[model samples]
Target: MKFAALMRSAALVTAVALIPATTATMAQVDGRAGPEFAKLFAVFQRVKASYVEPVEDDVLIRGAIDGMLAALDPHSAYLDGGDLQRLETMIDGNYSGLGLSVVMEDGAVKVVSPFRGSPADNAGIKAGDFITHLDGTLIYGGSLDDAVAQMRGPSGTSIRLTIFRPGRDEPLEVEVTRGVIELEPVTHELGAGNIGVITVNEFSADVGADVFSAWQDIRKEAAGRVNGLVLDLRNNPGGSLDESVALADLFLTEGRIVSQRGRARGETILYDAETHYRGDMAEGVPVIVLINAGSASASEIVAGALQDHRRALVMGERSFGKGSVQSLLPLGPDAALKLTTARYFTPSGKSVQEGGIKPDIAVPQISDPDFALRQKYQTRESDLRGHLINEIGIKDEEMESDSIADPRFQLTADELKDQGVEDFQLHYAMETLRRTTASTVALRPAKR
Candidate 1:
């Protein structure tokens, strides 16, 4: 994503008040919106004249702007100076915070997913948990920015969170210390039998280059030529769309990677492979992509593209369905508008809006004792209010199929722990790749 680059230009913020217009011209332009405009002005005048106390024009104007956008969708928002700086910081610098991706849902701050290895993640903050209070203060019906600000503090400082988990009977209280969140966008490991595991935490700047370098490092650290590859995107909340394209292009040679359709001409664009990278990075290696409820946006883009082309076997829980693309339109020097501009589609013309990417092999993280409980309450894009609906309707049954327990995957966490399997999903994926030979792996597209 060119989020940082988009902040350089100044954009015009359209206001409700018009300069001067004839009644007929205004009627022709806005389909007789004079009465609607009159109502809005009347409300503003009444609110200004009669209230508990006098409210500042700045506050009222900002509230009006926020209310207008709130009526449209959840993703669209007015970003003030702090919001812009925070977005930039998340992309390029480190900050001391709980390191959790959260969104306001019905005025409650709900955790999307905690960053892997962050303080919140270590504190056992799971996705779909609603944070009700911070430091003993009830934060219900508060702005998301304020809740986020309260959660962030200097390193080593502790904050108490009152969380209302869905299935739990009582509200859970947990204390967590803050730390500097140094986002490791791309991480790699050399597994046994010359298997390489590249875990993409987020699609930030230079992620494609980082993954390429990771493959080099894994090859150097390996005992023999690389036999298998695993691209782990679990709990990755996504970032730059361009980086997602670049990452997918690393493995794909030639095909439509993704396409975005929007009202504007510029928003509609088609991305293909052999553009960012020349050829497949791991040409003949058996590949598997791991995703879960926390994988969204750019993560879904990469997973959907790879799965559509049959480049990798996607194995994990269904992804967080987020097909819409948000474009950062700079409002001024210190503010911006993050507006949902387009909906992206996979190569198969599939929109992962409400119904997220379904894994080819549904593998639960049975290594965690709380897997069943967490999975039951796991939130996806469909859980968000005013979220974009898929152009094609989604079946309730389609979304529930992954939750069904399979006899082959009935191993309990304690049983897996006794067998030394800390992560059952990854362990299973690596094992599947190990037994497969290079000759059996198809680097080219299979016949339809």
Candidate 2:
């Protein structure tokens, strides 16, 4: 037997032994039958007995598993053996492949964003480009799973992609070599006279520790006279629930950080900053947070917490709005299930679902003159509404309970242009920090 077949057989044997034959039989005899269970069993038996082509039991079972999970929500998914391995690498923030984040759109796999400095980005793969073919094989209308499998491979292996740009009539082909992509969580630099600028790419595991260590290093370099802080969360697709909470605790003194609400079985989890994990920095020190469309999930948690507590001024376009909590459930063996168990709420108890976190200062990105037309035609949430799965059944009370009453600051359009900052959001943050700190310092009593 082939290795794949043997693995599948072993998986089935293990699954059967764990379930107990009585459980399967009892499913049929139970008083309250699950709608999904009945439908799945009926489909399985029909496919096994009536399909013209030889139907493998394993394939049918896996399909059922996928369907059941997909029905729950877009984020909740069943990771097969291979998928589980890839997920493990992703959570570690390192993977060997053409680094790209993709989503299925209009029967084509579209590049949502390419990781900075990755093979795809280096090869000029821009966000909003549709990938139609992989190595001359038409990939459109196919499963995203198959496309991801084809795109990922060993380091140094070259793969050709046929891309469809928005304005171009002809398809463009680009060949890229895969490599191991290691993401840097935090990068810092001294900006504008002793002001500390820290850009966080993502909130992964150990990100809080990394940020704290970086802050310590920056303070030592500045000799304890740091003027301001700019926390950049632009393009930071977030990670780790605990990391977000911990990071917020570093700055906040007294406020609820975030809240999670789920089914009756799972109690709400709340993180507050009043406990004081990290000592206060400069008193009334000006801090600004930068966010954009790519800032999501845990990133939103940090931004929302700081903003709600009046700790920092937030600037940028609205965030990507992925306020949901997912639990990684091990399925034994190498497989696993990433299931969405709950939705996240800001300190004020707002649900950032379809409606994302709106920035206090909105600074939209001005596209380059060459790509202006393409930018005008780009897709937004309205275009992909069909794919969104609203499973949590949230109500207005839950969403509005934590809304921000008043914003501390706002930025004008000309101010953004004058900064000449592509991430004008970050620039606004830096400038806000500078102004606030100067004001605070001016108010301090002179040394006697």
Q: Report the C-alpha lDDT of model 2 over 208-309, residue by residue, as the tens digit.
A: 888888888878888878888778887776767777887888887666889987663543677777554564444455676787667777888898887777
Each model's backbone clash number: 1, 2
lDDT of 1 by residue, 142-174 (tens): 888788899988999999999998877899999
Q: What is the TM-score of each candidate against the true structure?
A: 0.90, 0.77
lDDT of 2 at 56: 93
Model 1 has how many clashing residue pairs?
Answer: 1
Worst 10 residues of 1 by lDDT: 10-19
Instruction: List candidate 2 stretches off by more than 4 Å.
Output: 1-30, 34-39, 93-95, 103-107, 143-145, 153-157, 165-171, 281-283, 367-423, 432-448
Identify the runs in model 1 with alpha carbons over 4 angstroms from their true place. Answer: 1-32, 402-404, 438-443
User: How far is each candidate from the true structure, as Cα RMSD in Å?
Assistant: 5.1, 7.9
Clashes in model 2: which pairs?
Answer: 348-402, 349-402
Go through the candidates in order and give each one's C-alpha lDDT: 0.81, 0.68
Candidate 2, position 34, lDDT? 73
